[model samples]
Target: MAIALNTLVEEAERYLNASRIQDYCPNGLQVEGRPQVSRIVSGVTASQALLDAAVEAEADVVLVHHGYFWKGEDPRVVGMKQRRLKTLLSHDISLLAYHLPLDVHPEVGNNVQLARQLDIVVEGPLDPENPRTVGLVGSLVEPMTASDFARKVRIVLGREPLLVEGPQMIRRVGWCTGGGQSYIDQAIAAGVDLYLTGEASEQTFHSARENGISFIAAGHHATERYGIQALGDYLARRFALEHLFIDCPNPV
Candidate 1:
């Protein structure tokens, strides 16, 4: 039996606490689809290929980490936007996305997932004052060398981590999932031995050298893929819906 689109949206809204947060794009139902949803397809980004895969799979909804209508993005829906929307509308497939909300959610968030994978016990948010802060600070259950931690991250994530080694043993570590190099300062302020995130900017090299805090830039797409995968699995169990995670490799 298929669940109502409204029901699924409501579930997502509640699970993510979507209403309380300001996001880049609308959190749920960016495009309306059929009233009933039996199958869902998820991806890291709502790219053209992903949309096509969802349509082919007969998915009622396509859930993603990144959707359209970003802040300061072009409002005009002309070229890429027009095509993406057209396909969904034509097939009556809904598009639902959760950005930072998904990134920071305590249970299924990117940071927490990465922590779980790397065996880190998350104490709390890296930025204590902001609930929306995507980074987290915590200690390992058993302290290990920075190199060892980096190896664990690489093996668990199946990607080479960009490591800027600082101290001998890394007890306190701070991490954010995707493209979070900007939060290096936040991690340093939290007094962590190592800071781990997805991508790095050119300036990040300088930040590492000057701040004396170890930095790691794991692959953006690789680190981010886990959270939404967890989210999709959760939805599948809770809703008894058929869900598939579409993997599209991205080096960046």
Candidate 2:
């Protein structure tokens, strides 16, 4: 059974609490399509590949964690942007995206889903005083050497993570999904033995080494593949609509 396009968008907005969250891009229904939607295709990003896949799959709505019209991007619809928008417009496929909200959500959020994947017992927000912080403080089921934990990350993420090991075993941990290396100091302040994120900077190595906390930089795409799938499963069950998650692999 199909649902109205507006209903799907509204429910997603309410479920994600999108309006309350400040983000660099618009959160929901980036482009309007058919008045009704039956099948939804979700992905980590709204890349041309995903859009093409959605079209091939005959999806009515293309849902993603990253969407177009990001802040500071050239507002002109030309070149690549023009091609993407034209594809959606010509095919009558809606575009729906959620950035920070999808990262921070208590259920089906990227951070929380990643914790489950790695068996991290969540403690609390990485910074309790800051509502804007999307990272979380958590603990492992058992303490392991930093190297052992890094191996686990490699196994689960199917990519060799860059590890900066500290002298201590890892138990208490903090993490944010998708290019959140900048939060290392916040995790340090939270008294974590290790910190992990989707990407790392040169300074991240020094932070972990100098702070005596282990660090892992799992591939940004690998680390973030779960949350969008979880969200799609949830919406599918809720609305009795068909949902599919297509992963266009990114080595980075």
Candidate 3:
């Protein structure tokens, strides 16, 4: 069965309640491609390569984590943005994106997915007051060495994760998938022994060492892939629509 773009948008909006949370980019539909969507292609970013893949697959909808029209981005349609939009428009592929909402959703969120993979039971949001707080605090099913936990992350994420060992066996942890290294201090303040995120800066290494907290930088793209894919699968199953998660490799 084919789903109407409006219906899909309404369903997703209700599911995430994205409008309630202030985000960097306009959430939901950024680019209108087609009226009816029977097939969906989900990816981490709506880059040119991703657009090409979606076009090749004849995808009726392209759902992504990183959509265009970001805050501080040049509003003018030019350069790479122009090319990307042109491709989607020309191919009639609708674009749907969710940023913080996809990261924080309880069941189909990136953080929750990663925690489940690592057998981490979420206690609560790291920032109790902020509903949009991306990082989460949780505990492992059983205590394990920092190195052991690190190995588990690498195995699950299918990438070599950078690790910074701390003074304790890893029981409690804080994690935010996709370029959220800045939340390290929050984890430390929350009294978590370990913190995990995708992408790392030079300062991240020093912060983990000095803050007395373990750190792991699993690949940003890899760690974030699960949420949107799971969401797409759910949507497909719910609406009886065709869905394909198109993965575009990103090293950083």
Candidate 4:
């Protein structure tokens, strides 16, 4: 079965509530291709390799959490950007990207999906006052030591996270998927025992140590993989279309 490209984009926009959120990049269709989409390929990012995979798979559209055209990115299409756009245009494959929208969506959001995988009971937003808070504070089903929590993250994400240990036992925790280490301040302010994000900055270590909160930097790709998969599966079921999640591994 196949659906119109516009129809799919519209449905995704509605489901993710894309318009209301402010993001670094535009959310929704970043590039247009074929009008009718039958097979969709989903991934964490729309890198050149993913585009090549989509072309090889004969995909009608490529859906992803990260896409081009950022706030400060160079406008001129050249070098890697030129190659990537060339591949999509030559093959007539549509590109649909959702950044913050995919990270914050209630059902298919990255943080919520990670929470489900790790058996976290969400308490509330990291910042309760901000309605669009992308990070969340939660508690584990059972309290465990910081080392044990790091072990759990490694087992689940298939990558050893950089652990900044604090406190003996961790009960309440806060997390945001994909480069959200900066949210540690909010997590600290919220009084959570631990904080988890995909990547960590130099200051993250200082913040974690000073605030007495455990911190973990799991692989960015690993932490963000689930949300796009969930969204792809939903789109497949909802539209009765073929969906495939292409994983292009990245250590960071």
Candidate 5:
């Protein structure tokens, strides 16, 4: 089955509530391809490798969590950016991306998906007063040592997480996926036993040590890989179209 490009974009935007969230990049269709769509290729980032794979797959749309045109970036179309745009334009493959919306959605969000993967029972937002906070607070089924919890993260994420072992066991936890080390302070304020994010800053170690909370920096790509796939699956099931996820692995 096939649906109109406009219809699919509208439905996705509505489902994710994309317009309501302010993000660094544009949240909807970044590139126009064909008028009708039947197959989609999904990925974490719309890198050249993913685009090449989508072309090989004969995809009508290339759906991704990361897309082109961010704020403060040089708007001039040249170099790597030009090459990427040219590929999409030449192949007539649409690019649909969702940033903050995909991160914060209740059901298919990165945060919720990660929590489920780690067996954490979600309590609420990390910052209850802030509606736009992307991090979440949750609790494990049973308390475990900081090292033990890091091992679990490694098993679940298929990557070794950098852990700053603190004095507390991991029961109450806080996490924000993908370059969210800045939220460690917020997690500490919430009185969580552990805080996890995709990447960590130099200051993150000090903060966790001082606050007596365990901290882990799992790979950013590893953490964000699930939400885009889930979104693609939802779209494919909704429209009865074929969907494929092509992962371009990033160690960072």
Candidate 6:
């Protein structure tokens, strides 16, 4: 069954509580296409490659976690942005994106989904003081050594994670998906044995080593892929619309 574009957007915004959170980009429909949408193609980022894939799939809508028009980015429709917008407009494919809302969602969030995949039992928010904190602090079903935990992450994520070993055994863990390495300080304050995130900076290694907290840098693309797919599946089931996940893999 086909759903109206506005209906789908409203449903997603309501489910994600988009209006409640302040995000870098707009959280709902970024581009409008046809009034009715029957098929959706979901992905991590709405890049040109993903858009091209959506066009090839004959998708009526393209749904993603990352969309265009960040806070400080150029507003002009030129270069890469122009090309991507052109592709969507020319093909009449709607672009629906969710940023912070997708990451913090309890059930289908990137952090929660990553934890479930890695067998972590969520305890609570990493920053309990902040109600809208995107990161989470949790524990494994069973404690494992720092190296062993890294191996498990590698297996589950299908990519080798960069590990900065700390404690012998990892009991309490804190994690946030996609370039959340800066949260290591919060994790250390929480007294977690390990901290995991998608990307790491030069100082991240020093922070982990000096603080005695194990760190793991899983691939950003790999870590974030699940949440969008989960959202797509939920939408498909909820609205009875066909959904397809297109994986355009990126090492970073």
User: How does each model score on lDDT?
Assistant: 0.88, 0.94, 0.89, 0.93, 0.93, 0.93
Residue-level error in angstroms, candidate 4, position 143: 0.6
Stretches > 4 Å off in candidate 6: none
Off by over 4 Å in 1: none
Q: State in Å the error of residue 211, model 6.
A: 1.0
TM-score (all chains, Cα) for each model: 0.94, 0.98, 0.96, 0.98, 0.98, 0.98
- The reply for model 3, stretches above 4 Å from the true place, is none
The residue-by-residue lDDT of candidate 3 on 1-252, one tens digit each, is: 887899999998999888988889999999897799899999999989999998889899999999989899888999998899899888888999999999999899988988888899999998787665788999988999999998998788778889989888888999999989988878888999899999889999899999888999998898899999989998898899998998888877
Q: Tens digit of lDDT per residue, candidate 1, span 32-137?
A: 9899988999999999999999988999999999888888988898999999999999999999999988998999998898888888899998999866677899
Q: Per-residue lDDT tens digits of candidate 6, residues 110-167?
A: 8889999999999999999877567999998999999999999999989999999996
Backbone clash pairs in model 5 (N, Cα, C under 3 Å; residues 3+ apart or in different chains), count: 0
The residue pairs that clash in candidate 1, if any, are none
Per-residue lDDT of model 2, residues 1-252, tens digit only: 999999888889899999999999999999999999899999999999999999999999999999999999999999999999999999999999999999999998999999999999999999999888889999999999999999999899899999999999898999999999999999999999999999999899999999999999998888888888998888889899999999998988
| Model 4: per-residue Cα lDDT over 176-200, one tens digit each | 9988888899999999999999999
Worst 10 residues of 6 by lDDT: 125-134
Q: All predictions: root-mean-square deviation over Cα? A: 1.5, 0.8, 1.2, 1.0, 0.8, 0.8
**RMSD of model 6 against the true structure:** 0.8
